[model samples]
Target: MLGPAERAWCVVVPHQPRGARMARHRLSTELVGTIRPGLLADVVAVLAELVGNSVRHAAPLPGEVIRVAWRHRLDGDHDIVQVRVTDGGGGAVPRLRPTDLDSLDGRGLHIVAALATRWGSDRDGLGQSVWAEFRAPAARLPGPDGDDPAPNDLLATR
Candidate 1:
């Protein structure tokens, strides 16, 4: 179990067709509950780009699956939300190119870096997971306790 200081939440999207569909289906539903409206918008946008990148670049073969996961955390005083999109693709680390300004296709990563607090990638036996983190609003509160009398109660806001 994670300490209260750790604000991150981890979600796993398996590497299968059903997993991919499930991932998409859960995006709005899950995030709507976990994230604030404004911050949620940013997170979802970044997620779309990263997930699309995985679909286009990752996936081991013609019909392989991609895995995606995300977690929210607090690093120091900053509240952070991190997302990881994993796929079987083993391409080079994505980069932002000057020419990307003129092209419509390659700006995804650039937009991610601009909007996210930090972003990177990792490759292990499980394949690759590209990650991005964004700072939530300072006024935002931590999530509710499971046993709260009022289900709408948020820890930090209290």
Candidate 2:
């Protein structure tokens, strides 16, 4: 469950080629001292892929900006991280493609799907948002009754 300590971080950048790099750097810096190393890598990779896709496909309108937001929280006993990238809508919706091994491109969503426990996108009047969620190893902590909760019990709380 998310507590008062769980706060999301967000940034908006110009919808340009360099925006993806900017978003990635911001995400890396925000996560540097907070998350575990292995999980951090996966989260960063997903951020890059999603941001790159937005830059490549969903080009923003003349004065529009891309929005990136991320948050880390404890859902029951699990540590969950969620990220969202939104851009102006003008391109085809993103989907997983069946690319051959020799293809030089079209693998970003596949990587995202593999790394993220769950991922999807939403579209509104402004644009579309691609979001992904990653779960890290749960930290064992004593429950209200002064005993650690079982894994199944923890899941049930969620």
Candidate 3:
């Protein structure tokens, strides 16, 4: 859910495969800065794939924008991070059907499907946002002797 004033943030993505310097930005950093590196990588991979799909498929109109946003929630004891990538193209339907192995395209959504715990789309006849959610890793406990361990060492054993 985004307010009208905040919608400008959605205009940064390039609608078509070709463009003149399409821009991109991340609207959420709360979990981005807090999640484990490995888990964060997963989130980023999906986000990139979704954004790339928008740029490749969504035909951009003149002076249009593509925006991205994210929100976090708790699913049972696990953390759920939801990411959305939106563009100004018409609500073009996207499918994840199988393609030739030699084709380089059509794999983006497939990757999202395999990685996201859940995913969907939201359309307003103008454009849509492809959203995906991932379960966060278990919370790390403080180290012995009342010290905070390095992020890289949180699950590593010496």
C-alpha lDDT (0 to 100) for residue 147 of candidate 2: 92
lDDT of 1 by residue, 93-119 (tens): 766666444676878888899888899
Compare the candidates by lDDT and give the number of the best one.
Answer: 2
> Candidates sorted by TM-score, descending order?
2, 1, 3
- lDDT for 155 in candidate 3 is 32
TM-score of each: 0.70, 0.80, 0.67
Candidate achieving higher TM-score, 1 or 3: 1
What are the per-residue Cα lDDT tens digits for candidate 3 across 1-158? Answer: 73221121233554543321232225334344455566666777787777777776675434655666665543444556677877765455766878788997778888888889988888766567678888865445467766765544433422
Which model, 1 or 2, shows the larger TM-score?
Answer: 2
Candidate 3 displacement at residue 156 in angstroms? 26
For candidate 2, write residues 1-158 as lDDT tens digits.
54543647888877876887888788888766455677888998998888888877887744767888999775655668899998886467778999999999999999999999999999977678999999877545456687976533543343
Top TM-score prediction, candidate number: 2
Ten residues in a row with the worst lDDT in model 1?
A: 149-158
